[model samples]
Target: MPVFADVDTGVDDAMALVYLLASSDANLVGIASTGGNVDVDQVCRNNLGLLELCGATAIPVSRGADQPLSAAMRTAEDTHGPAGLGYAELPLHQRELTGYDSAEAWVRAAHAMPGELIGLVTGPLTNLALAVRDEPNLPSLLRRLVIMGGSFDYRGNTTPVSEWNISVDPEAAAEVFDAWGRAADAKVIQQHQLPIVCGLNLTENIMLTPTLLSRLAAASGATTTAMSVLDSRGTRSTADNTLIRTLEDAMRFYFEFHFDQGEGFLAHLHDPLAAAVALDPSLVQTRAATVDVELTGTLTRGMTIADWSHRWGRESNAHVGVGVDPAAFFDRFIERVGPFARRLQADR
Candidate 1:
C-alpha cells in the first residue's frame, strides 16, 4: 500500500509512524505535520527524528498549518508530554521539509499517485480541508482514506461529546466531512469510496498494557523488564533494543496519564490502530453514516454526529468504525514491530 499520513506527532502518532515503517506492505510516501499534540514545528521535528531513528529518512515530511481553521489552537502537552513523545527523546536529523507546504503536498501526492495512494489522517483536519478546498477532486484521487478521530455515540477524550482532533478544529473537520458528502453524492468516480472513520468508540478498545510491552520486548530479543504500576512514576525501560526502549519510555508516560484519568494503567493505541486499518480495513467493521461536525453548540461544539438513520437526508460521507478485535490488533502489532526492532538493533 502506498500511504500518505497527516499527523500531529504525539506518542501514539509516533507509534503509528513506526508501525507503517515496519509493515512490509506499507510504502510510506510522505508525512504532513499538523498542529494538535503540539505546535506544527515540533510535530515536524518529531516526524524527522522518528524517521531518522527508524532508518526511514527518505520519506518526505511536510509542514502544515500553524493553527486550526476557526478556533484558538489547543495542545495536549500534558497528555503527550511537553515535546509530544512522552519521556522518549529522538534526535531530529538535519533534513529539509518538502519544498511545498502540507496542503500542496497532499495535492501533489494524490495527483502523482492517481488512485494508488491510501490517505490517512490522525490529526486535526486543517491540512486535508485546505487540500479539499484547493483540489475538489482530491476525494476521488485516493485509493482509500482512513481517519483516526471523532467519537460515535461514545464519550470524548477532550470533552463530554467532542473528540480531541475534531475539537481542535471543528470548522476544518466540518468542511472535510461536507466535502466528502458532496463527493459521495456526486459519485464522480466509479472507484470512489467513503472515508473510513475510526472513532474512539472502537479505538479505545485497542489498549496497550504493560504485559504487551513486555511481550514486544521479548519478541525483539531484548532483555525485558516488565512495567508495573507499583514502580515509581517516570520509570524508564531498560530494554537493550533501542526501538523497544524508546517505545517503552513513551508508553510508560501514556500509561501513567491514563491511570491518573481513572482509565487504569492501559494506553489506547489510537493512531496506530488507524494506521493498521488503513492497511487492512477488515481489522474493523464499520457502519455507513452521514457524518458532520458540530460547530456552534455551547456544550456540544466539535462533536461529530452520525446520522445513521438518514435523518439528515444526505449521502453517507463516512464509514464509522463500530467494531474491532483488540487481541488481533495487538497480535499483528507485536509480530510486525518486534522483528523490525530486532533488525534496527542489528543494523546499529
Candidate 2:
C-alpha cells in the first residue's frame, strides 16, 4: 500500500498522482520528480503545487537529474503545455523538496519498507536507473513496479519507432531492463512478479471522452457542464468541484492536442491507467517477456523489443501488458476520484 511515484508531472502525470492520492488503499510515501514532460525543476514545482491543491502537502517530493542519462533532454511542451499542467493553473506553493536526491529517495523508501513498497514510474527511466545503479538489489526490494512507457508490437508516439519516455532516455531504459534481467538470472527475487509494463499499445486504449468527464463530475455531486467537441478550443469547465474544474481545464488542452494529431477529440489516460495497474495488476492481462531497449538502431532507437518466445535466452524482466478493460479502469477511476474530490470540496 506504500506507493512510491516517479513522475514528470505532465497533465496525465498529474492525473496519475491524483489517482494514487484518491485511492483509499494507496499511501503515497514519496514522489520523485524526473525530467521528461518538463524540466526537473518544473516537475518539482508541479509536484509541490499538486500536493498543495489536494491538501496532501505532507508527501515528500525529491528532484532528479535535469537531463537524461545519455541523450540531450527533450521536453514535450507542445503536448503537455508550457508549464506541464496543460491549461490548468495550480497555486505556487512554498513547500521545499526532500533533503536527499531522487535516487536516494528510491533507495531509502525501499530499505525502510522492504518488500512492502509499490513503485510506479510514469516518466523516463533516468531516476529509476540511477536508483538501481546505486542499489544493485533494488529490483527485489519492491513488491511491484509498474512503468508507463514503451510500445510492444505497436506504433510509437515519438519517432517512427520510439515511444516518448524511452526515446528520451534509451540508455537508462536499457539499463533498468538489464538490471531486472540480471536479478532474475541470479534468482534473487522472492515473488518472481516481474515489473508490469504499461506500454503505449495498451495505454492508448484508455481514452477519456467528454461524456466520461461529465459522468465523473456528476459522480462528485457537482454542478456539471458537459464538454463537447463543438465547443471552443479553450473552453473551461464550469463544474462546482474545484478538482473537477482543474482536471477539465487540463484535459481540454490534451483533447485538442490529440485532435490536432488526428487521433480524435479524446485524450488517453496513459499514466493514470498505469497508476491503477500498480495497485491492482488484475486490471490488465500481461505476457512475460525479456524486454529490451534499442539504443543504436538507425531508425528505431529507443524501440522496446519484447522477446515473448525466449529468443533472447534471458529471463523475462517485464510482464508486457497485452490486454485490459478500459471501461473497468474508468469505472474505478470515477468511483475513487469522484468521492475524493467531493470530500476535498466539502473541506474547502
Candidate 3:
C-alpha cells in the first residue's frame, strides 16, 4: 500500500520509518516532518538522512509544523537526545525539501493514491489537523489511519495524564479526533472510516531486549551504494556494516533510559507497532470507542478519553487498542523485518 508518514523522527520514530521502508508491504510515498522529538527543521533532516542511508532518497519529504496548533512546543530531547536520534549520526545531505506546506504534501499524496493510501502518524497531529482543515473528506480518502499516541487503559509517559505526542499538541489531536468522529462535536462515522490507535497501553507490551538487538545486528549486513546520505561522496566506513552500527549507536541512549525506568535495559517500541498495525490491523486486539483528547483538566490535559464501554452513547470512531501478544508481535517483527533489513543493508 502507498503509505504517507508523519513523523517527529525521534529514536522510536526512526525505528518506525526504517521498519516501514524495509517492509515489503509499505510503499512509503512521502514523509511530513513535525516538531516533537526535536525541532521541525531537525526532524526534516532526520527524515531525509534516514532515506539517504537506506538509499531510498527518491521518496518525497517536506517540513510540517514547527510548533503545535496552540500549545508551546515541548520536545523530548531528554529522551531522544539533542538530535532526536540519541547518539546516532548520519551524514548531512542537500536533499531538497519538496513542499511549501506539509498539509499540501499530505493532502496531495492522498489525492494521488486516493483510497489506496495508508496514513501512519507517529508524532503530534499538527500536519493532519492542517490537512483535515483543508479537506474535510480526508478521512474518507485514506484507506486507514494508524496513530502512535494516547494511553487509554494505561498511564501516561509525558505527565500524569499525557502522552508526549498528544500533550505536545492537544489542539491538533482534538481536531483529528473531531474530524474522525471521536471528539465531542464529532458525528457518527460513516461507512469508510478505519482508524486504529496504538497507544502506550498496547505498545508497552513489546520491549526491545538484547535478543532482538542481536537479531537486528545480524540483519544489518546488507549491501550499500557509493552515495552516502552523510555526503555526496561515500565515507570510508564498512558499507555492509553501516546500517547496524547506526542503530546500535542510537539505541545506546534508549536502553539507558529504559534501564533508569526500571525496565531492565530495554525500550518499549511505541511507534513501530503502530506502523505494523497500519499494515495489519489483526496484530493487536482492540475495542470500539469514541475517543477525545482531554484539553481542560489541569492534571489530565492531553490524555485520550476512550469510552470503551460506550459510556457517552456516542458512535465509536476508533479501534482503541486494549491487548496484544508480546511474544507473537516480536516474533512476527523479527521474522518479516529481519530479512528486509538484510536486503536494505546490501544496497551499497
User: Of models 2 and 3, which has the larger lDDT?
Assistant: 2
State the lDDT at 265 in candidate 2: 93
Worst 10 residues of 2 by lDDT: 186-195
lDDT computed for candidate 2: 0.93
Model 1: per-residue lDDT, tens digit, 143-240?
99999999999999999998999999999999988988898889864423679999999999999999999889988999968999999999988989
* TM-scores for every predicted model: 0.99, 0.99, 0.91
**Model 2 Cα RMSD, Å?**
0.9
Candidate 3 local lDDT, residue 165: 89
- Of candidates 3 and 1, the better by TM-score: 1
lDDT of 2 by residue, 185-279 (tens): 99987434478999999999999999899889988998967988899878878988889999998999999899999999999999999999999
Task: Rank all candidate structures by their lDDT, best first, as comma-separated numbers.
Answer: 1, 2, 3
Off by over 4 Å in 3: 182-192, 220-240
**Which whole-number lDDT from 0 to 100 does residue 192 have in model 3?**
36
lDDT of 3 by residue, 1-348 (tens): 899999999998988888887778889999999999899999999999999888788998989977899888888788887898877898777799994778999899989988889999999999999999998888877888999989886889989878888999999988898788842234433433547888888998879875677766555544433222233221332335766667666776777667767777678899989888888888998887888898999889999998877878877778888888888777767776667667765655
